[model samples]
Target: MDFSTLCVHGCSKRYDTTGSVSVPIFQSATFVHPGVGLSTGFDYSRAQNPTREYLEQTVANLEGGADAIAFSSGMAAITTLMEIFSPGDHIIATDDLYGGSHRLFSHISKKNGLTFDFVDTTDVQNIKKCIRNETRAVFIETPTNPMMHVTDIAAVSKLCRENSLLLVVDNTFLTPYFQRPLQLGADIVVHSGTKYLGGHNDTLAGFIVVSDAALAERLRFLSKTTGACLSPFDSWLLIRGIKTLAVRLERQQQTAFRIAEWLSKQDKIRKVHYPGLPSHPGYEISKKQTSGFGAMLSFETDSKETAHRILERVSIIQYAESLGGVESLITYPMLQTHADIPQQEREARGIGECLLRLSVGLEAADDLIEDLRQAIYGGKANV
Candidate 1:
């Protein structure tokens, strides 16, 4: 089935009890066993839930994976995957990554005896040189957060396959609707369902899709044992949100392209980083890998004061950290999403205090551009 059809009809079925087209949320905490010797499919809500199962199955199918597991948050899914490696194991990850994921790899994982080396994965040779005998996984996020750097997924996946290392790709920026990492040879695909998968800011959830059945089983065990399973209600919401993903993402992508183009022509903007922009460094690779340019974009201003002034002046876009929602959001990466990283390290990666990240929404292209234009020019005109 095509992606559009799968969005609406995948893993969702009408039931007699509700007599409704929408899948009913099974909110019960536990399921009854059939008898002493026999048991139903679900024994407890924490271990399994009908709604979450439907969501997991749908995500797995969309990503072309054997199975899927849902977690409380994106970090929960990531930490669970990290658990597959033992102490003294090393990981090679992209230097430009989601701040939260970077924190886990650099700080939290270190305490657990996991070591990480951050390198620019866009240069495949550099990534190969960073791998060591102790390396267990290659963590990648194409079109990385804030910087919008695109890593070659297939190249890294091939390297991992040759070296007997796991390749984990964070697919949050371009959801399965736009890019399927598993189809590109990735071993595991991770998502912050709170973003595009949910298509709204109401729910916080995470999902992992893996082509290997054994890895799926291991993730299931870790999910149940660690108690990071997603709640039934949130899972139901995610299911509903995913049904309209194609439609929502299409509109959001259009807006993003327009905004990115307009931002590039602005005098106050020093540089615009968006895969859709023809001048973008990863434009060719992005076209080869993703079906569409995603809804996230970033631009650098002349100064930190100018960036903050624009952020404070914008009326239509909200000042928020999360992205991939129906509504537009603007964030100062240095202080908001990437604040956890040390100053020197962020500077080394070219993430400056003057850089602003925007998650474009399904709004009128002209209105969004006007709002941004005014924010940047209005403050100075008044001054």
Candidate 2:
């Protein structure tokens, strides 16, 4: 079936008794067995829930993975994935990432005894140079947050294979509708389902999808042990959100491309970071791997003053954190998403104080463009 078809029908179960299209939420904490010493597949909700199981199965199908596990939040999924390695294991990761991820690796994971090397993954050589004997994995975020740095997944995966390392890709920006990292040789694929997969900013969830059976088993065990499984209600919400992934992303990306083009032409804007733009460094490479350029983008103003003005003035496009929803959101990386990284490191990564990331929504392109214009120039659209 086509991706659009899969969005609605893939891996979804029908109610045998009621023939309900929606996957019912099995809200019970524990299940009853019919006989002594007998049991159902789901003995406890912590281990499994019918609603969550359907969500897992649907996501697994979407990503072309052997299995998928849902979590309470994106960070929870990532934390659990990291637990597969012991204290001394090191990882090579993308330099520019979501602030929360930076916090996890730098502050929390380090205390747990895991070390990380952050590098510009757009160039495979950086990853190659960072690979120490103790390096167990390469964690990457293609079209990386704020910067829109696109890494060559297949190239990195090849390097990982040669080095006997796992390649984990965060598919949050593009989701399965636009990009399937597993198909490009990623050992593990992760997502902050709170974003595009949830479509509305109404719930929080995460996912770990993988093709390797052994790896899947390990993740399953860790999920159950950690007890961070997504709630039945959230799972149902994600299922509903995913049903429109294809259409929502199509509209969102269309608007994003227009916005990026407009920003590039603005005098107050110094640069635009968007994979969809031909001038972007990652444009060609992104074209080769992903089906679409995605709705997330970032741009740098001529100065901090101009960025501040836009942030304070935008009326329709909200000034906010978090992305991939029905409403457009603007975020300041220096203060919001990448602030956890040290100032020196953040500057080195090119996420300066002037940078602003935008998550385009299903809003009309012209209206959003007008909103940005008035916010930046404080005038009505003349053209």
For candidate 2, what is the TM-score?
0.98
User: What are the runs in model 2 whose C-alpha is more than 4 Å off?
Assistant: 380-383
TM-scores vs. true structure, each candidate: 0.97, 0.98
* Predicted candidate 1 versus true structure: per-residue lDDT over 96-142, tens digit per residue: 99999988887889999999889999999988998899989899998
Q: Which stretches of candidate 1 lie over 4 Å from their true place?
A: 12-18, 379-383
Candidate 2 local lDDT, residue 262: 92
Error of 2 at 111 (Å): 0.9
Q: Candidate 2 at residue 135, lDDT?
A: 94
Q: What are the per-residue Cα lDDT tens digits for candidate 2 across 1-383?
A: 89899889858565347878777887789999878989777789999988898899999999999999999999999999988999999999998888899899989899999999998899999999999889999999998987999999999999999999999999999999999999999999999999999999999999999999999999999999989999999999999999999999999999999999999999999999999999888999999999999999999999998999999988888998899999999999889888778999999989888999999999899999999999899986433
